[model samples]
Target: MGRLIYDGEHRPIVLDDRTLAHLKVVVTTKLRRHEGFTMSWRHPDNQPRGRSTIWLHPSIPLKFIFDAPEPPELNQRWIQDLMDSANSSGGIALVDEVIDGPQ
Candidate 1:
């Protein structure tokens, strides 16, 4: 598990290491370009109703912390899907991580 600390909030948004890693990439890319966008995600614990969305800006302070020391292998397809969403008018939509298994 990993935590995304946004805007110096007391509570951090929890996410899996793999998902967080990929998000870090996508988010940093957009922020570097001074682009602000909305990011939405379903509650992993399914608590307090459905989903939540937040506006991410380059000026905001964001941190990513992973429990594991080493990063996990990434799926290129998943990254592409996330990138597509981030580039959309609606902005970034975080979906469940897709694990590519051996055929």
Candidate 2:
């Protein structure tokens, strides 16, 4: 599991390495362009049943930590989906990754 620490907060948002990796790309890209957005995600099975959203701004401090030393392979379609949501009024919603085609 990877942890996303935001704004020097005590509680780190836990996410799988793959999801975090994809998010890091989209988030950094947006921040680099000076665009702030909100990111929402449903709590995983390990956490209490609830949803959480965070505002990401260029001035805020964000950190992404992965358990594995090597980064996971990114899904372009998934990244595009995330980017689309980030540009929407609702902002980015952390959903499960979609496979390209047949399993």
Candidate 3:
């Protein structure tokens, strides 16, 4: 699993490396543009039954740590979908990457 440590929080939000990789792209783009958005996701099976959400802003400190030494190839379609969501009123909803989209 990968870890996303925000604002020096004691409990880092853990996610799979692949998901974290994809999310990193979106979060980076948004923060680069000084845009902030909310990202929400359902807890994994190993965790308690619940969901978590966080607001991402450029001013906030965020770190993405991966178990894998190298970053994985990113999906452009997934990134576009995430960007679209971030532009929406509801903000980004962390969804599984859809491989059906064009390569």
Candidate 4:
């Protein structure tokens, strides 16, 4: 199992290679298209921080793209939506749900 660390706190969450791969597609495609959006999420077992919001945009100083593998089904409309939202002034939006998958 991989851990989701918020700011500095660590919470346990399941993260499989497939999930990481899918996430990579969702994020990178958005960045490449110049869309902007926000994602809010709370890691399971990490109630201390409550919730976290990430501004998904190319202009942001942080990058989660380099950390994941590309997904095969990255051409879905949802992917486009993510990219569009990420590119727009509104930025991409996401809600956090602790991944519960293989270790």
Candidate 5:
């Protein structure tokens, strides 16, 4: 698991390591360009039902923490999909990880 600490919140949002890694790339890229957007994700099984969305901005304090010592390999297709979502008028919506293999 990985943790995304936002705005100095006491509790961090937990995400699977792979998902967090991809999110880190998208989030950082947007923030670096001083672009702000909304990010939405469904709650995990242990958490409440429904979904959550947050407005991410360059000024906010955000941190990405990975359980593994090293970062996971990224999927370019997935990154492009995520960037598409981020650029959409509806904002960024988290999608399932895209595995590289015959379907």
Candidate 6:
């Protein structure tokens, strides 16, 4: 499993490489604009809990597994929201989330 860190929370998700790279770019741009982000997703099947949440902050340097399988499609709304927030903030304050596992 991989660690998904965001919004002051850390969790895991199943994701792939291309998606991770894409997410990194999106997050970096947001950080350049000082916009903080939030990510919410389901917990791993192994975990007994429910969904999870994290806040990506500029103060944190995040890492993720490059071998995990990423979802085929990205949530366009999320990317747009991040860009919009980043543009408004002048820089992104945090990365927001990280998907665990091998991408």
* Candidate ordering by TM-score (highest first): 2, 5, 3, 1, 6, 4
TM-score for each candidate, following the candidate numbering: 0.89, 0.94, 0.90, 0.46, 0.94, 0.49
In candidate 5, what are the lDDT values of residues 30-93, reduced to their tens digit? 9999999999988889988989889999999999999999888899999989999999987889
Please give the RMSD to the true structure for each candidate, in Å. 1.6, 1.4, 1.9, 7.6, 1.3, 9.0
Write the residue-wise lDDT of candidate 6 on 1-103 in tens digits.
Answer: 2344443344445544654555666877766777667654555466788865556677876665565565445656556654554455344322343444577
**Which regions of candidate 4 fall more than 4 Å away from where they truly are?**
1-16, 47-49, 61-103
Off by over 4 Å in 2: none
Query: Candidate 6's C-alpha lDDT?
Result: 0.55
> In terms of TM-score, how similar is model 1 to the real structure?
0.89
For model 2, which pairs clash?
none
Q: Point out the worst 10-residue segment of candidate 5 by lDDT.
A: 94-103
Q: List candidate 5 stretches off by more than 4 Å.
A: none
Q: Would you give me the overall lDDT of model 2? A: 0.94
Q: How high is the CA lDDT of each candidate model?
A: 0.89, 0.94, 0.89, 0.49, 0.91, 0.55
Estimate, for each residue in 27-95, the C-alpha lDDT of model 1 and write its tens digit. Answer: 998999999999998876657868888899998999999999998877888888888999999888997
Write out the backbone clash pairs for model 5. none
* Residue pairs in collision within model 3: none
lDDT pick, better of 3 and 5: 5
Worst 10 residues of 3 by lDDT: 94-103
Q: Which structure among the candidates has the greatest lDDT?
A: 2
